[model samples]
Target: MKSARMLPVLVLAWALALGNILTVGIAVHAESPAAAGSLAAPESFGSISNPDQRSAAFFTELGKVLTHPRCTNCHPATDRPRQGDLRRLHEPPVSRGPDGFGLATMQCSSCHQETNFDPGRMPGHPLWHLAPAEMAWEGKTISQICAQIKDPKRNGGRSLADLIEHIGSDTLVGWAWAPGFGRQPAPGTQKEAGALVEAWVKTGAACP
Candidate 1:
């Protein structure tokens, strides 16, 4: 009897999760070159008349990008960075030391170069490093990310307005949209995701 009751909830959760995946897929398509000219991206959070619901949807959509391998690989819960779509342990082994850079002398920049196009080696960034401890997103859901993003303590002291700018224009965040070579880009372009962030912020930055 208990199993039957739990079944419905489990099924509902699965359905919701699948629906989220589909929604992200469609959203990516909508932002592609084919749909670019016709689609008016979200202007602001409050621009949606249904502020609360739109806020929810915006987070849901943004979650698709956040939960993707590109983002999660770096935001891993463990000290070690993950790799590939499989989310396996990084091959050579690495750890996010005190500075969130890497284990002492073995900094990430030692290998990853400024650009990726090459799969033979890890890519690099001028500031290539893991996110701060507070920003870990590896095991989190969209709702949890949303809540954390709104907290001054968790969000690196960023205000709601600051978040809009960061998500929309941050160079690092933009990189996910155009990760070259072997890596798969995040679901949507940074511009589109930024628009969603803007819309979510305007809609009172409601948490999921």
Candidate 2:
């Protein structure tokens, strides 16, 4: 009689445990990172026989990363930088100030430290500031941005060769790949992006 009574309790306990497992599984899936996409290798475009066409194609591949929210958020057309994957304007209404950093009373480093704070969902780097106004990429076409990048006046005075180092190895640029919590990283690895830049330069840096 006691075992008969315990049978119902045991079955209820099993059902509760199963429900908990299912809930956890669903929660984990929901919180997982979204597909951030990928970039084609530079060699993959070798099939294009024309150098100009090949260079343009290479840059077009690199454009996948350049045009992503990760790159565009900091390169806002307006003085106010954006945040989040949705590319929303930053809260608290901070401006780019005379420098790329925020106004005197509200510097970016004040909230963003040297590393990401997952608890607060804030991303950081040692040099956390917006790109210069002239270099803003937001709302620009790939070809327009391409033209701007090749211009010393608009590209922070970087030469085509300088861009390779900046994109491939700069820690600040690398941060896009490792942006903390709730963010989709830019497409592909930095090295791949760098290789595309190199290939594009070698092929005459043609724009799409």
Candidate 3:
């Protein structure tokens, strides 16, 4: 009878101990550096008020995607494109041949097709090739990319309006969001990226 009575108290003590542990865990997480919040929303850029500052800030936000592996891989400073999130060099010794396509024997179209093939772990889009040599973004600062993106001579002759359209609606850019075979997608949706580009242009297209 005494043992049975002690069982209730023991069970109650364990429950209290578990509750305390959970409470401490939550408090620790709340205080931890790893618990920082996510990226600021696009609307938050409006808080800058200064058009130049806000515009530059907008591009900084869009920079999240522009610098991501999906975009940067093809925009390598060297002739070879990188692969995967690690930004490793292209395997099988590919190079950016004339017209940004591979050599006749090993064209990008030889592997990357119209869409991603999950079975092959190959990411594909109809336009899967290197950006022009002038448009190389690898090893450049976001500010540099920002400036180059706005320059007609460096940006493949695109006007600011053309840039807005390209970033805002280009299907090739959209492919960054749906990279297949278990790769990490870019920071946000392509539409969200486009909205940032549009906002950046509308405000002043300032470089960070």
lDDT of 2 at 74: 91
Off by over 4 Å in 3: 1-41
Q: What is the lDDT of residue 87 in candidate 1?
A: 84
**Judged by lDDT relative to the true structure, which candidate is superior, 2 or 3?**
2
Lowest-lDDT window of 10 residues in candidate 1?
32-41
- lDDT per residue for candidate 1 within 7-77, as digits (tens), equals 99999999999999999999999886434342235654445567788788788878878888888988888
For model 1, what is the C-alpha lDDT against the true structure?
Answer: 0.79
lDDT leaderboard ranking:
2, 3, 1
Q: If both were scored by TM-score, which would come out higher, candidate 1 or candidate 3?
A: 3
Measured by TM-score, the strongest candidate is: 2
| Candidate 1: residue 142 Cα off by (Å) | 1.0
Candidate 3 per-residue lDDT over residues 1-208, each given as its tens digit: 9999999999999999999999999999987433433435679876787889888998998887888888899899999999988899999889899989888889999999999998988988998888999999997899999999999998889998898788778888778888987676777677777788888887889999
Candidate 3 or 1, higher lDDT: 3
Top model number, lDDT:
2
Q: Clash number for every model?
A: 10, 0, 0
Displacement of residue 164 (Cα, Å) in model 2 is 0.2
| Model 2: per-residue Cα lDDT over 46-124, one tens digit each | 7899988999999888998898889999999999989988999999789998889888999999998999998889998
- Mark the regions of model 2 whose C-alpha exceeds 4 Å error after superposition: 1-37
